[model samples]
Target: MKRIHGYVLLRESNQGIPNLLVCAFDAEGAVQDLLGARRGAERPTLTFGKLGKRIGSVLTGTDGAFELTRDDLHFEGVESRPDLVLAVLAPEDVVDPRRPVALPPEQRILYISAVPRSEAGAEEAYVIRLQQAQLDAFGIALDTSADNAHKRIAATQALLGDVEAGTQIRAQVAGRLHGRLKTQHRREVEFRDQAKKAVQLVALPHGLRAHPLLLSEASKLPDLQKKALTEGIRHLKDAHRPQLRISLRAAELRTAGMKLDRRGKPIGKINTLKLADVLRNMLGGVSLVRKDEVEPSALSDIALRARSATRTRARGAVDRAGEEGQGKALAREPGRTTAKAVKSATPRRDRRK
Candidate 1:
């Protein structure tokens, strides 16, 4: 009785028969003859109203079989393209053939693309568009497979747990050294430096858990080296907590992989950071916190010395100012100025000529 528009979702429901539905129109307007239509069979250009929203071609069995289905059309709401739809899959809605989908406010139809595609050039473009929409809006592009959502979530939770565990271990190790810093601070300079390198070895958050080589490297860290690193961290932390954080970050950079763009890097590739490479990079970064960290007492001494120097300079400046003022006053008085001028002007009898 009425003409409306929607996208055609052609999917195999049973027995290799692709059930076709125009999402804009209800089941009454659905094209069910797709089962009889060949894969490349000629389908009509279906449109509705004056807007001419492309509902895609209908692959009907007979030349005019589509007309009989179109005649079954009734008053149902229509939309152009993949307009978000309300999906109601409750038990009541499942049992009832006439139940309208209930869309709670602000809820969206999930990733299932209700947009119909022609059998030709539409797939790749639609895929790219969907990927872009997900990435741009949500800060992540999820795998398009409908069945992989739970697996993806599980993998994410596992990764987060690993990161947290790595952080806890790193903290525990650092704490053990910090508690005994007073006793261990006098370790040999070479030993301390080696310990710093050792800390860098274990700083790789992801690699530590993911890479077998890294675990071996961690297990091989000598006790002296470990102690040295703990002492270094404690000293740096005492010197400046921020410096310690920076050192840890620098070490992290050497040992960890950066967030890679999806376009370039393959997913699930574990980055192999070598112990030698980590040691080399650690020489620069791990020592920085130790070097930059100034003791609180040393800082206080510097302040005190600076203040004393400043006071001395101020006193000298005051003396100079006083002399300048006296000279200016004498110059302002005409008689005093003349007397001084005459005294200087009088050719000193050149006894030492």
Candidate 2:
């Protein structure tokens, strides 16, 4: 039944080293809701979210001051705000020093630590730790063969076994890893396909069907059309691996069609025209640009259309004005008097004769 909550504070260092800090509040303490738009104050019983368990957790002291060391530090990627979660740990969940059952969550502790552990392989341990934490916190179970097995395999699969057991265990672990990979791959493909169909495409290239428009990246593209092209390519390519052929950048972004008048004023709107959608365009074929290339300003599809329309209107006006001038000159020619005036002049001349 014990619980705690807190806000994460961002501490920046000039040297670019990763350090983490969490300002945990009492179980019923008052704090602003960082996750909300209104950010109203709430006193939730469990604020330290589930991920709090894996992150830097420091024990509280008698003086109400929780000290943290470099060992308790690790950086998580960007968060809307620093927030903690609640842990309803049973008394038996006492193995972790961070969650000592003897001390309640009211101490309002801060967690920090130094990560001296080096990465074992290609991926950094910290990144994996963060991803694992996320998966553990909000993971769903699958009723696959792995769960149906009656074998009570624990410790990430057979840790202690006979002399020949090492090879067998390694093979078992490899099989499990392969199974996990296949499941992940299947889910990723399904999700990507769904995303592609859901979004109204503003621009799509032929070759790179796997990659879709990244709205987060596109919104940052420059506003001018000339610049939107060059800069959009640079930003898009930078987001992925150097070798990844991002055939289209802003071009793939979804845009809202802004219906505009001849004066460049918005006469109507297309709902999808977000900032990023306008900076890119889709052509008959995909545009290719390397990460080392140029940058451009942002412009919307509506704006481009409006600009074109305005130019067309101006040209038509000039043509109409010339036709009207010629018509006026013909009406003002010398023998062009009205019928009544001509009759009056002839009658006076006939009477005198």
Query: 1-353, model 2: which lDDT tens digit per residue?
Result: 12222222112211111122233221222232332344353322333442242434443222112433334434357321223332222112244587665433422222222221222121221110122232233231222343324234543355555535978888889888998989999999999879978984656455554543333345545444556577788988785754533232222322344444568455444354453343344434444557653334326677669879999999999999999999987887686887786778786768688
Q: Ten consecutive residues with minimal summed lDDT in candidate 1?
A: 84-93
lDDT of 2 at 134: 24
| Weakest 10 consecutive residues of candidate 2 by summed lDDT | 9-18
Q: Model 2, stretches more than 4 Å misplaced?
A: 1-31, 34-47, 50-54, 77-353
* TM-scores vs. true structure, each candidate: 0.15, 0.14
lDDT per residue, candidate 1, 194-265, as tens digits?
Answer: 987787445557645675333344566676477777878888778453432223343344355433345744
Q: List per-prediction Cα lDDT, in the order shown.
A: 0.40, 0.41
The RMSD of every model to the true structure, in order and in angstroms, is 34.8, 39.3
Q: Please tell me which predicted candidate would have the highest TM-score against the true structure.
A: 1
